[model samples]
Target: MTKLSPETILQHACIGVMGLDNNGIIQYINPRAQELLVCDTHNGISLDTIAPQIWKQVKTLIQQGMNEQAIHIQGPRGGIEMVVSPVDKKAKTSSDNFNGVVCFLRSHEKFESSAWQYPTIKEMHLQFQSLLDHSYYGIYIIDGNGIVLRVNDVAAGLIGMTKEEMVGMPIGELAEKGIVDQALSPAILKSKKPLTRPLYVVKSNKYIMASGMPIFDKKGDIRFVVVIEHDMTIVKELRDQLKHARQVADTIKNELSDRNLLELKSHEVIADSPAMNQLLTVLLKLAKMDASNILITGESGTGKGFLSKFVHQNGSRKDKPFISINCAALPDMLLEAELFGYEKGAFTGASNTGKAGLFELANNGTIFLDEIGDMPFPIQAKLLKCLDDGEIRRLGGTKSIKVDCIVIAATNHNLEKQVQQKKFRQDLYFRLNIFPVHIPPLRERREDILKICDFYLKRYNKAYNQKKRFSEKCIEQLQGYHFPGNVRELKNIIKNAVVIKENNVLDTVLPPGKNKAVPISPPCEETAAPPASKGLNEEILAFEREKLTQALNHCTSTRILADYLGVSQSTVVRKLKRHGLSVE
Candidate 1:
């Protein structure tokens, strides 16, 4: 018999694994289980005798050659989720003859408490009190009878009720009493199913967003309903701000009508550091090549989207279409339709005429998938197919459409870490990891901070028609700031500073002394005054080399050094080569 490839390595995994023959006799047991169960498969043991609750599900999955869902089984050592798939090394057909079952077990020690019994209110509270208390989202729970079994402090405070006052009160009674708005706990109880949201409750003039799920018993009967609620006070305020913004939106819209939005939106990267200079140089090189799939990784608001557009505009496909989509902005179904396009009548609300997808529209150009990490698993699989065959099959379409396009994906997520946790696919990660570029955070590339700040300052001044300027002390203070939000944050700070102040020197907003605690690095002098030890030219060259050496430790690549030195990247390369400097 052939050894299951994954199972051989999974054999030593901490989670127990067991194999059963077609006749329900144990043929193999991994080391973890051997120690736990105190038995070897040499002595055939029936799984039915060991875990009667799980054997039924296992037997069905093995016979069918696959299982779509994991089966959670409770045992002496808490609970373990079992995933079963057919072990076939050579079969080409989807149907594989089942010789034996290889079952992988995943431990669920903490989750076990929830999977098991909901004994008494006190026990329930004891089992989950710590979790509920520590969670930022308010937690409320009800029993099958709709009796409020538990309400954490956060939940109680949201409704102006104490745990004692809320407990034992039927949710229906509470809803009728109008203590808070109607709860979704009742819907979960009525349907005996999980629910995502409930009608907003108006208590203390605050709208509460609530969602819950119904827990079940061994017999699959409704046992308890747990809901998490969040106060949307700040969110409502932001919404109000949006409404006010719309009041002046028309003036801005009319102003933009005569201007090229893309041209206006386009921002030139400010590279006054080695890190950024090298990045810009490489970006241009990649743009010229224009065929390879590129992945840009960075923190949010670090100009990843901007860099991608820059690449497309500079590329061979500059005249062609450039399409972009945020993978996270739409739901899975909508995102899929938007990317691959769906045929007319494909679903209940699909377009009358099949709409062309971004991939098709971006043919011969570039398609930017922003926040690609949030893409749905199904879409990821389809994208892999498209990348492989250079053809995409629209939803409910029989024919595949060929597309010649550059795929550039950007994300703030650690895709490699996501793959390890099984949240992301390893194959897809490897495909995207090819030609990877990581944009450094603004804090790390501090040399570029002032340049970016000044760019935004000048632009905002032009837009607002105010000639406000930052004092030298203000610049120094800004440089000292950690700028945790990076360039994006710096831009906002500059805009706010200019708008709130009308004076020529908008310095007092930050207060020069506020950032004194953070050490300012010698006032960021690009070039120092000539020393008397040698002639001016020699002193300047010596100073330039010293700056390069100092920046070399902070800047990893030639591009960064070039940006830091305020020179063309080629010049930095030539200088480095002359100085016998080399990098991997």
Candidate 2:
């Protein structure tokens, strides 16, 4: 038999063969090598540019001083295997004389051998297994045919099975066997892309987030599916618990809000009328919001002060101090010192040890500035600064003390009109009016009048230990009257009636001739007084007749007469009969 030449043998060889110089430049590549590498160039080309994956493994081996030994590497293409061996042209005995390398490539389908026949392949497999075993999260790898090629210890444990029982099993079988909730690798193969889904392991009773990524071959075919599963049982439990807690908190808040609205009467706030009730509803929500600056506007004696306190009591700062000050009651200089506080020896009558102002004293609470419309212009500027910056300087000190209190200002005067008249600062008004609450006067919410009257009647009745009850006529008179002083006037009238009434059934509360409306004139010259000389009883009768005549002139009917005289209809008729008076 004749020995074939090296070039003829290489050309006829079934496996791929390539030669590289010391510089890693392809010196020669057989036809089979070109086909396997998908390279058109035959020579003088860098191996790094042609087969980068193979070059990487070659560089790794060379760096490890193992280039002389034949080593097998898993090539870039799926099922493509490579063997790299250092070439010594001068002598085959030592690698010191090696100047180039020869690479033998073969398809894995065509190669069959034992572990010892390819030590590098066995070592690479061991390295891969070691990496998978060391991972904290479950790692599962499947071949393109949906068969499990390898699984980490974590993955096997999560499935409640051993690595031996899982390898070579199809992914679909895991779901059908009740091992996992569903197959995730199939979706990755279908989309040829990564997919993430929530998964449940039946055996372990654990929730997991499985992220599947597809490994594709150079031909863009699915090569393998890699799935990483992270346990989500604790996170899911925490999220559910948080959601339940929030729902419970919301229910409690709603119940408390309704209860607070109903208990407004206990706070001495009468909101029975639709107008006042609506206002209270808004105030309740504002209180819950913990509004910083709120302005209460209404007529005098309409209970602005009570409403201010109501807001403070229901708010988040209920535990803090509540300091109230009447702006109109204090002089300018004294008011400033009282509000912002004064330093020691700051003024002529300053306190010896210095005093904290209402604002400072009311820190982290609420400060009710009653009659804020009457606050002096000079002090309004400083108050505005405090509101804007949340800090106030002492009356005569240089340092600013920070205050975190809610400022609720109440005013009977029309602040908008005052602002236009230049009597109040417009900016300050805007600041305080961020959340405005307008209490309707007694006349506007007349329905609340009877309720307020009854409340005060009961209060005063208890306080004075009296069982005096207003007669039907008296109730009619009280309800019909146009209260000029609002609730305050009503309260005082009820207190006086409950305290001074001699009989259990009180008939008259208002003075003899005082009417619901302010008199057009103080009682004409004739109705004013009887001549002192006329006897006492005769004088009393004459004066009563004169006031009756005057009331009759303005009142057209029995109801009108009763309302004008501040008496019930029956009282008016009886008084008319005694005085010989009648409506035409």
Candidate 3:
């Protein structure tokens, strides 16, 4: 029972070991330590040079006479745990004595490769079987011949088969679920590369994405194929939802377009006064003519564009393309390209295949130029040329293409004044003024207010799928207001009311304007005073008279006044007669 010496112990131990003196120099090195450190002998190598990071801590322990301690060290090869213990207590005679520190080294847990080594083939098989039974992702391994060597529990469950039944089956059998074609296995075998594709498990009624990668052996030859399958049922469901939403949006768009067409067809120019009727007659006549270049002038939101469209749709070009372009919507270069086609490689980032301008697209049709006054002078010249001569030249191309399109210009500005100020071309203005169609403002067409409201109300009701109707009071309030935004403003008001109003009640929270509702006061108590004091009925009559007077003063004609009052033109005339007033 003799105690083994340090050398004898080191010879038998598997791990590396070395002893260091208090000066941080390697005093002893075992054969295993030399091999582990990748050094022959500690001839010129010091403990600090071999492991500087750990030596610092060791020096501190030695200086303080610390007891047994251990530290984890990282090296180029791998990680190691080093233990230091003092051999003798009085060996440090003057801090440079021959006293030694015994060092024991062991490989780190992660660096110890012995865990991967199986004692026997039976042990390795059991470990693989256990992993295959518990993995959530469908796992399968195939040999070089595309034959399945192993199948996991998840894979067996996905294909509605037991692991024992699926094992040793051809990999092609799983790929034939009608998700991917039958040629996928042969392709993977030929290419020896990874393949990924979306597939559905017919038996489980679930979608899955399958990926297979080739495993190469030490000779760089394909040894096996590892396939992983992920379920994609939620992803497919989300995609379907997005597609349904787009379809619903398209349906709504088509319905809106149909409603707009119906409204235009049923609309009538309602004006009882001679002056307004004369204007409407001229517009209607011009709308029917094919040669007139109509210029519609009005204030912003005053139905200039709407009337322009009405003219086009009712004209001889009704079957042709009715293209509308806002002249002021874009900058000069973009607007030029939009109107004129650009050649390939004309400028940086230009479309490689080039583009066709709007003018060419409007050939054999009619082009409605909205905000004509806002078009740049250079583009205006081109437009004038296109009108005089039926030809257009692309941005960078030399060829001039012939066009047969009618031009319909619309504006909210006075083009005559623009022409005088040299802002607009006089010749262009005269060409456009062949037939002038002036759309009177909302304040001038009071007779059409309620009609327009009813139209808009029905439109919004169908759009929102709600059963709502406007009350008589709501109609009266709408008619009484001066719509500065014109027909467009009226349409917006009706739309907003439709959204806010519930159960057929119009919300009174109107947009900002003089037409906003004023709070009315209750009738005052009649006191027994002099006979000269006006009665309640008389006072009410006076109030009504004053309102009628004010409305007539601000409006263009009686028809407008009647519309604002939400009453018939005859009622307005009768009221005017009773008050001894004339709508001048």
Top candidate (lDDT): 2
TM-score of 1: 0.43
TM-score for each predicted model, relative to the true structure? 0.43, 0.54, 0.42
| Alpha-carbon shift of residue 527 in model 3 (angstroms) | 49
- Candidates' C-alpha lDDT: 0.74, 0.81, 0.72
Tens-place lDDT per residue, model 3, 313-414, is: 767878888787777654577777888778887777779999988888887777888778878888888878877888888888888889887678888777
Who is ahead in TM-score, 1 or 2? Answer: 2
RMSD of each: 35.1, 12.8, 25.8
Q: Please write out the lDDT profile of model 1 over residues 268-336, one tens digit for every residue.
A: 767677887677667777887875689998865577888898889878899999998878655688888
Candidate 3: 10-residue stretch with minimal lDDT: 521-530
Angstrom error of the Cα, residue 184, model 3: value is 99
TM-score winner, 2 or 3: 2
Clashes of 1: 13
State residue 365's C-alpha deviation in candidate 1, in Å.
Answer: 0.7
Assess the local accuracy of residue 235 in candidate 3 as a C-alpha lDDT between 0 and 100: 82
- List the candidate 2 regions with Cα displacement exceeding 4 Å: 1-140, 144-195, 199-208, 216-222, 230-238, 257-267, 270-292, 313-322, 330-366, 376-406, 443-454, 468-484, 502-584
Residue 43 lDDT (model 2): 91
What TM-score does model 2 achieve against the real structure?
A: 0.54
